[model samples]
Target: MPTLLETYIENRFRVQPNHANNNETLHGGTLMKWLDEVGAMSAMRFAGETCVTARVNELDFKRPIGIGDTAVVESYVYDAGRTSVHVALRAWREEPRTGEREETTASSFTFVAVDSEGKPTPVPELEVGGAEGERLRDRALSRDR
Candidate 1:
């Protein structure tokens, strides 16, 4: 079994002109792509198998990230079933120099592990035991409410 913390993944992307809209903020599609990529990585880490996104819950964009800012994406597996891994994802607008960050986007995703034949494959049980693991799981769960 893999612990919940073992499935955590974080990645940062520097918003450039190509990733921004006419208003000079990160484009929604670009952010969504980054979120999906990070979420899939976390699911794969937990499942130990190729995972495909099954569903994406509501994505709420709280603020815009400027072109020169950095988008920090974090993801972790909070819960899992026989074949499905549930991941919580969050993105923050960060100032590289000041190291300041503010939440910009939040969402959850469901991914299913797959075999070579593209059929569903079973995933190992997630160990959310320890205080750190439990705290992480609780925080993710609470965000849904």
Candidate 2:
């Protein structure tokens, strides 16, 4: 059994000129790619197997990460089924120098653990407890519902 905290993942992506759009903000498509990458990694940590993206729920880009800003991405598994894991993901734009942060996007993702033959495989049940685990579980579940 793996705790939710054990599956948590966070990554920072520096917004560069190439990653930005004509408006000088991070491109939405690029951000989605990053989100999927992090989400899959989180699911794999919890599943202990290769995981593939099944679904990415509604994506809402609330704010733009300007060029030179850092995009902080967070992902964690909140619930799991026999072969599927539900992950909660969000991204925030932060000033690299001052560390000021503001949420930019949020969404729920579902991942399915797969075998070498590309077929779905069973995943371990999430064992959640402790203050941190409980808090994340509650937050993810509420957003998921």
Candidate 3:
């Protein structure tokens, strides 16, 4: 059985000219696209098959990442259904030199495992047996203070 922690993913994107808006900050659409890509990867790891995004439960853009900064996207599985996985994903804006960061986006996405024919398929039960897994799941389910 795979644990939620094992499905975690973290990736960073440079806020370059191609990824930024005229204001020199990361564009909202660009951030959303990156979020979906990373979220799907996390869900697929848990499902062990190709996964298709079914829904984005929540997405809040709390801040902005300036040009030359790094956008760190993190994701992990928090729960699972018969054919779907629930994932928590967030983006943080970091100063590449100083390593400072602040939350820029937060989201919950649902992905369904699919067969070659693109039909939903059963996925293995999600396990949260370890302390890390429990902690992560709890944090995802709780409201930030």
Q: Write one digit per residue (lDDT tens) for candidate 1, span 1-145.
A: 9999999899999999999999999999999999999999999989999999999877999999999999999999999999999999999999999989999999998999999999999999999978988988998888878
| Model 2 stretches with alpha carbons more than 4 Å out | none
Superposed by TM-score, candidate 3 places the C-alpha of residue 129 at a distance from the truth, in angstroms, of: 3.1
Q: Tens digits of per-residue lDDT for model 2 on 1-145?
A: 9999999999999999999999999999999999999999999999999999999876889999999999999999999999999999999999999999999998888999999999999999899969999999998888766
Whole-structure CA lDDT of model 3: 0.90
User: Where does the lowest 10-residue lDDT sum fall in candidate 2?
Assistant: 136-145
Model 3 ranges off by over 4 Å: 143-145
Clash count of each predicted structure: 0, 0, 0
**How many steric clashes does model 1 contain?**
0
- Give per-residue CA lDDT, model 3, range 20-138, as digits (tens): 88888999999989989999999888888999989988889898899899999999999889999989999999999999999888889889999999999999988887899899899
Ordered list by lDDT, greatest first: 1, 2, 3
